[model samples]
Structures are given as C-alpha cells and as structure tokens.
Target: MTENGAQLFARLETRPCLKDIEPQLFPEGGGPNHGEVVELYGTEGTGKTEMLYHLLCRCVLPVATGGLEVDVVFVDTDYSLDMLRLVSILESRLNAGSSSSAESDEAALRLCLSRLLVVHCSSSSQLLLTLHFLETSLSSRPGLALLLIDSISAFYWLDRCEGGASAIRQEEKLRKCAELLGRLLSDYRITVFTTCHAIKKVYNGPSSGSGYDRPYLCRPWQRLVTHRLLCSRQETNSVAPSAGGSEEQSRRQVFTVHCTSSGSRTKAYRSSSFCVTDGGVKFI
Candidate 1:
C-alpha cells in the first residue's frame, strides 16, 4: 500500500540532536523527515565530524532521557570515528540526570552505545561494498533511523589521481555510489547525513577572488542532497567556560546554515552557532 504525506509523517522518526541545535532546520519543528538526504559540508577542522558524533549519540540514547533511542549506522570513511569522544558526550548526558540512580545511568549508557554500529571504509570500493551489505541489515532492523557517512568525498582526490587521463571513469564510480544511496533512501525509509569538503579554497586558506565557498561533489551526489548544512569555523578570541579549567576556552565559533531547495527557489534558515568542547557540541 502506498502512503500519503500524513502517513509518512506519522511514521517518521524524531532526531533530538537536530532539534537541540536548530529546530528551524526542519519543517514544523520536526527533524529531518524520513528518506531525506542532508549533506554537511565544510573545510577541514570545522567540527563537521564532531557534530555528526553528537547526532549519533542523540540517536542511540533513550527517549526517556531526551533522546530518540533509535539505531544508527555510521560509515567512517576518514577513519575518524572517535569512540572515546562519543563516549564522553554520552556520559555527560547520562550524568546530567537529576539524582538518577547510579545503576540506571550506567545501564542507559550501555544501551545507547549498543544501538550504534560503526563501519570503517578506507577506499571507495570498500564503501560501495559496505553499503551493499547494509541492505540486508537495514531491512532487518526496523529501529534503524539514520545512516551517516563521515566525509562522502573521502576518496575524491584519490579517485581523480588514479583515473589519470580519464575523468569519465572517475565520475562513473561516483555516479554508481550516488545511485545506490538514492535507492537506499527510497527502499529503507531512513534519513542520511553525509559530510562533504569545500572546493572553493584550500583547507583554511584565504577565500578566493569572489570570497565564496560551495559544497563540492559530483552532480549525481548533488542531486541526492535534499538539504545542505554549510559548516564553517570563525576565528574568535572570546573565551567560553569549560567543564575543565578556563584554559580550555573556545578557540572558534562554528556556524551551520541549513538550506533547502524547492523548484527553482532555495530557502535557507539562519545559521546557528555552536562550539566544540571536550564534552561535545555546545550550542551558543
């Protein structure tokens, strides 16, 4: 049976992390609806992966404890999934309880981590194969809500270098990957968050002549991105209080702007401010 918009909305899962950071990013204060693809693009060290980990923590945590309590599939292409960092954030959330029993806190943390499944893919071929294997898992696990790829363009330069004289061959592989992702979105009913690199400037180099940066990905992948979050770090001298000593002040403020396109018009919500700390992403 085919479901209409209301039926689909009823079935859609909630993402507490997005709500916490920026409720305006989603329609009617709901987080990314089912089958939506979001791309988080930025230059290096813009807290992109950290933001993803925060979202992952929120997905796996219990709904009773202010989380969605759903399963997550994290594809770490850059091999940057910091288990320790994720655990720290999870622990902070658990400990913030109002005199909750110690055993309950420990149990909740265990349950949250258990629901998360991380897969590491070092090469583009491995990433493709990993997604293929995930099909069976996705079908079997109804609790799964999100599939996250840390830096979808992890192999972009590598693929280009290997292609040598033929850009067509390089693009062909990327097109196949995008097709698979689109199929997964339609077939599995899951929200996706993938990170992309900015192409307008070198990592942290000064902005070019026009001083604009854009998300860089193949056309096929671009088509799959329904919503785009542009992340950037702004240099700042202001100090933010830290859980640790004052020595750990915030060095930079991170901004994320949510953009969605309809027909030929594009609408972007105001940017949100956050800072990365040892604990996790702190919205400011």
Candidate 2:
C-alpha cells in the first residue's frame, strides 16, 4: 500500500532528530524526521565530526539519564571514529546528568556504547558494500533512529583522479551510492546524517563572505540533502572569558542550518553555537 504525503509525514514526524541537542532548530514537536538526509559541511578542523559524535551520544544515551536512548549506526570513511573520545564525552555527559551510583553509571555507559554500531570503510566501493549489508542490522535493531557517515566525500580526489580525464564514471559511482542510501532511508524509519567538505567558490575577490562554502557531494547525494548545516569557527573576543579562565580566549563553532523544504520562508535560518572541549560539544 502506498502512503500519501500526509500519512508519510505523520509517520516521519513521530521520530526524533537531535531534539535533545537543540530542539529549537526544529518545528514544534519535530526534529530531523525519518527519511530525511542532513548534511553538515565545513572546512578542515571545523568540528564537523565532533558535532556528529555529540548527536550520536544523545541518541544512544538512556532517556532516564537525559538521552534519547535510540540506536545509531556510524559509518566512518575517514578513520574518524574515535571510540575513546566518544566514551570520554559520554562519561562526562552521563556523570553531569545522572545522580546514579558509580557502578550504575558505568553499567549505563556500557549499555549505551553497545547500542552505537560503528563501521569503517577505507574506499567508496567499500562504503557502498557496507550500506548494502546494513539492511539486516537495521531490520534487527528496531530502536535504531539515526545513520551517520563521517564525510561522504572521503574519496572525492581519489575518485576524480581514478576517472582519468572523465568525470562521468566518478559521478555514476557516487550516484549509485546515493541511490542505495536513499533506498535504505525509505525502507527504514531513520534519519541520515553525513559530513562533506565545503568546496570553496572561485570568485574574483577576497574570499570573506557568506555563501562561499558549498557542499562537495555529487549531484545525486546533494539532492538527497534536505537540511544543510554550515559549520564555521569564530574566535572569542579577548574581553570575553572562556570556560578555562577569565584571561583565556577560546574558539567556538557556529552552525547555520538552512532548510531546503519548499514551504520554508526565504530567510528562514537557524543557527547554534558550541565548543568542543575534552568532554565533547558543549552547546552555548
């Protein structure tokens, strides 16, 4: 039976999308819904991946302890899955939120860690294969709500060079991968989040302006992106003190999220600020 637009949206809206992280970014009673793809793009060292880890931790932590308690599947394409780092952040968050005993906290942390399934892929082909086989796991894990890929453009330059004077083959490979990912999103009720490099615009002038950084994924995957979150860094003013001390300055990231939905207003923009400390992404 084919579901109509209203019915589909009703179902999608029931699921959550980083609601705990920043509920204000979403509509009333809604976050990143199921079957939607969200892209986080930024230059190197912009804390894009760190932000994703924060979202993942929110998903896997128990609801009783201030977490969504949903399962997450994280596919690491750039060797960016730092388990120790994630655990550190998780421990900090759990400790801060929970008044449970030490043994109970440790048990909850272990349970949350088990819910996050991590996969590593070194190449694009391997990525495709990983997505293809993920269906079984997705089916088995009914609580799963988010699927993440750390920088889907991990092989951008390599794939371009491998094309050898032709870009069609490279585009086709990415297109096929996007198709598979889309099918998975449609078949299951999960929100997809992926990071991509920001392609610098080659404009004739000093490169300091808005809308200069564009997503680098191929056209197919680009079309799948329902929400685009641009991450950038801003240095704190010397007059303002950081968490460390009154004399210390720190850098924070600003995320500007743009919704691609047709009904959205022209200037409907949402922004959030956060910093990545040893604990993890701290929303400010």
Candidate 3:
C-alpha cells in the first residue's frame, strides 16, 4: 500500500538525531565516509575519555542498539587510561542486558569482547600501527568499523614530545603529523574519534589578564577534522558536600558537553548533567 504524507511524517518523527538521543549522541546515516575526521576536545577530567568508552560500548552492541556490530580502534597516547575500569563497565553493562533471556542479545556481549582492539602508543610511528590493524581486519569478511583516539593533543605537548624543540619547527611537525593521520583515517574508510586538548590562550586586559581555551587550538589540525566538539566541565549535580578549599576525597569537576559541528550548534539534546560512576564511566 502506498503511504500518505502523514504516514511518512510520522515515520520521520521516529528517527532520532544525535542531540535527541542519550547513548547515541552523534548523528546517524552519513558515516564511514572517506576524508572524515572527528575531533573531541575538552578540559581536564571533563568526561572526554569516559565519553569515548561510552561510545565504544555502543559500537559493539547489536543493531537493536544502533550499533554496527563491528570492531573499533582505540589509541591511548597518554598515561591517563584505566583499563580495569573499562573492562568492569563493559562486563557489568553486558551482564545487565544479557539476563533478558534472549540468546541473540547475549551474542552482542560476546562479540564486543572479541572485536574490540586497543593500541597503546607513545610515538607517531606507533600511532601508524592502527593502519596495520585495519589491514588485518580486511582479510576476514567485511565491515570492520570505527577508530578512536583519546586526546590527540598529548602528542603535541612539549612535555609529551621531544624536548628543546623550536616553535616553528614544532608546529610544522605537528601540522604534518595531523595531515598524515588525517589521510590514513579517511582513506581507510574507518571512523576516527580523536580527542583533542585545548591550548591556553591569554587575553590581555587593562586590570590584568585572563586565560581561556580557544575554540580551535591548532589551526592546522582543525582544518583536517570533519567534526569538532568542545567539552567543558559544567556544574555537577553531585557536588560533594565540602569546603575549606579542599575535600576528604579528590574533588572532581563536572562538565556540560556542547557540540559545535555541521555549521551550527545542535539542539534537541537530552543530557542535563553526567555524574561520576564506578567502573570508569556511565551516563547517569
């Protein structure tokens, strides 16, 4: 039967955009396209790594959960990764979903463990190993998916990279590195979720000066990214009861995530605030 305009409109309304969804906060449909690079940047402890972990969980889920049921690449350049926490989060979530008595659903949990790949890199050459991993996946059948880097800025940081480097030379190296990584990510037809760090910018004033993280920290790297997200620590709903400029436990900052891409800021989003949970990360 031929559907009328109203029927089609109703169906369209059912489709969810990135902002409209909680677990899947990125747009759908236009994906795996070549020459595309996504940059996720935020302040310190602003749920950047945790967000990637969240997406990683979703990527391995079955089609029912908007996942491709495929593999993903994770590049850990910095030392701030919690492997045990990640495992615990994945296991706990899968177990909760698996108890539903659906055998097919359980398969999602199994496939996720086997398909997920992690690479720890401290150098640019090691970063290129991601391509080799992708190449290995091609031999099986088809549909090997997704790449994620938890903060690309660490590579460019003076302390992270070589010491006593020239400013112009340093930037040039960074630019070329960005260009190189950008090409591989696009050409390979793999989704790259790269986390970037914001550089401190000083604004001079009459009274004094204040520093802020600019929207785009690296101009050269910025041009290569297909999607760029700025994540900042927002007011935490679970602001621990503390004072005296200190707390019993480590005081963690909460952040409100705002995405700016595809021409303008996206509306129709869900999350008001995300709280810290056990086993690494989970949106609460």
Candidate 4:
C-alpha cells in the first residue's frame, strides 16, 4: 500500500524522540535522535567502555527507575565487556532509586538485563554479518532504540594485514559495515553509538589537543558519523588527604572527557570531566 504526502508527514511527526542518555556529556539536553550516529574516539584506558556501560544502563532500566526504558544492542568487538561490572552499576542505580528489598532489586536487575542484547564479533567480517543479523532483529522489535559498537576500529590492523598493499581491499570490510549501518538507520530509525581508538598521533593539527586523533578509518565510516566525540584522559591533582592516608590517593584517579560535535545543528563544543570508580563513570 502506498501513502499520500500528508500521511507520510503525519507518520514522521509521530515518531518518538529518544531521551538523553548522558546529560553530563551532552549538557544541552537534546540527545542522539533517530537515524543518528555518534562516535566516541580516544586512546585506551580513557573510560570509553565505562561510559558505554553507563549509557547501556540508562537504556535498559525502566522509566520509573530513571532510565530511558528502551532496549539496546551492544556489539562487543574488543571483547572487553565486563558483565559483572555492568550489573554492579545497574544494581547501584536501582538501589539509589528505590528502597526495595534485595530480592526485588534482583528481580528488577534481571528485567533490565533482559532488554540488552550482546553480540560478540572477533573480526570485521563477523561484525558485518552481525549488523545484518541486527537488521532482522530490529525489524521485529520496535522497542530496540539504540545500537552500540564498542571500538568499531577493532579489526583495523587485521584487515589491513589481510588486504596486503591494496588500500581499497584494506578498507573494504569496514566500508561495507558502514554502509550496512547507514541502511539500518534509514530503515529502523535507531540511534547508533560506536567507539574508536586513537591509533595514530597528530602534530600541529586542528584536532591535535581536542581529543580527536588522526583519522585512521575509511572515509565511509568517517562520513557515517553524525556526531564525533573525541575522548582523552589525564591524571589530575591528588584528592585531599583522607582517613585512609596515601592509600586513597594512589587508588583514585580523575580524568577529563572532551566532546566535540561535527554535523550537529548547533555545531557546539563541550567538555566534561569524569572519574571511574567501583560503581561506574561518575561525572564531575
């Protein structure tokens, strides 16, 4: 059946807008909308995974429990997802929201976890296949509003080695992956959040200190990104002496996160600082 122009416009207007998953990082309030892609790139140990966990919790938990209450698909390319850590953070968030008994909290936790679908991909080929699978899954589940890929650049080196001297062949897999992502966004209108690592260093460049490393991925993947968040970390001054003495200072480390948006309506630059704790990434 075909729809008229007025009908199409009405349907578009009825589409829901996703809530801001990380208000601390995007202080302006509007979060990634449907069909938008957000990329977080930085060096290792910069709390990118921790930030993903935070956002994951926000999507999986129920609305009454202070979450967006939408389902999420997490693609673990680096094999770095710590389920125990994610559960701990979710439990803490749930505990803070209500004074429910231990048994009830456990039940709530289970319910939240049920909404998240985790897929593991060891190589670029597998990642591409996984996205194809997700397209079918998304078509069946309208509640699935977010798609996350931890370190989309995971297979860069391996693919480059396999491609062997041919630049086009080297980037072929990732380029296809990006094309699939674009298709998924267009068809399902789901938001995407992926992480990238800083594989190269830049000197005297515009994004040198802005947390954006040299672009190492293919142009297709780069162009697919609607919002690029450059992440970086640095050790700050030691906290004031506490009852634990020097022990506290050594264990605690604070790092700042800088975010810059390209292709956004406002085209603004924002930065936020956060520290990773036993629970999760705590913004300051």
Find the candidate with the highest lDDT and give its number.
4
lDDT of 2: 0.75
Model 4 weakest 10-residue run by lDDT: 7-16
Instruction: Pick the TM-score winner.
Output: 4
Instruction: Decide which is better by lDDT, 3 or 4.
Output: 4
lDDT of each residue in 3-56, candidate 3, tens digit only: 655554453343222221233344453322334566667667677888787777
Model 1 residue runs over 4 Å out of place are 1-27, 201-212, 239-266
Clashes of each: 0, 0, 5, 0
- What are the candidates' C-alpha RMSDs? 5.3, 4.7, 9.0, 3.3
Give me candidate 3's TM-score against the actual structure.
0.68
What's the CA error at residue 13 for candidate 3, in Å?
A: 28
lDDT of 1 by residue, 1-284 (tens): 45655444444433213433235445455455567778887778887898888778777877666777888999999988888889889988778754888897888788898898889998888888988988877766767778999979999988888878887777766778889988987766788888887666445556544333565567888887777777777777766677775655546665555455332335546466777777788877
**Structural similarity to truth (TM-score) of each candidate:** 0.82, 0.83, 0.68, 0.89
Residue range 1-284, candidate 4, lDDT tens digits: 45655554454454445647788877657567788888888888888888889888988888887788888999999998999999999988898848789899999999999999999999999999999999778766767888899989999999999999999999999999999988878867888888988876556855566434567799988888877777777777664666866535454566666676667476767788889877788888
Give me the displacement of residue 158 in model 4, in angstroms.
0.5
Backbone collision tally, model 1: 0
Candidate 3 regions with alpha-carbon error over 4 angstroms: 1-24, 27-35, 64-66, 100-110, 129-141, 159-165, 204-211, 215-218, 235-254, 263-272, 279-284
lDDT of each: 0.74, 0.75, 0.58, 0.82
Q: At residue 253, give the lDDT of candidate 1.
A: 63
Better of 1 and 3 by lDDT: 1
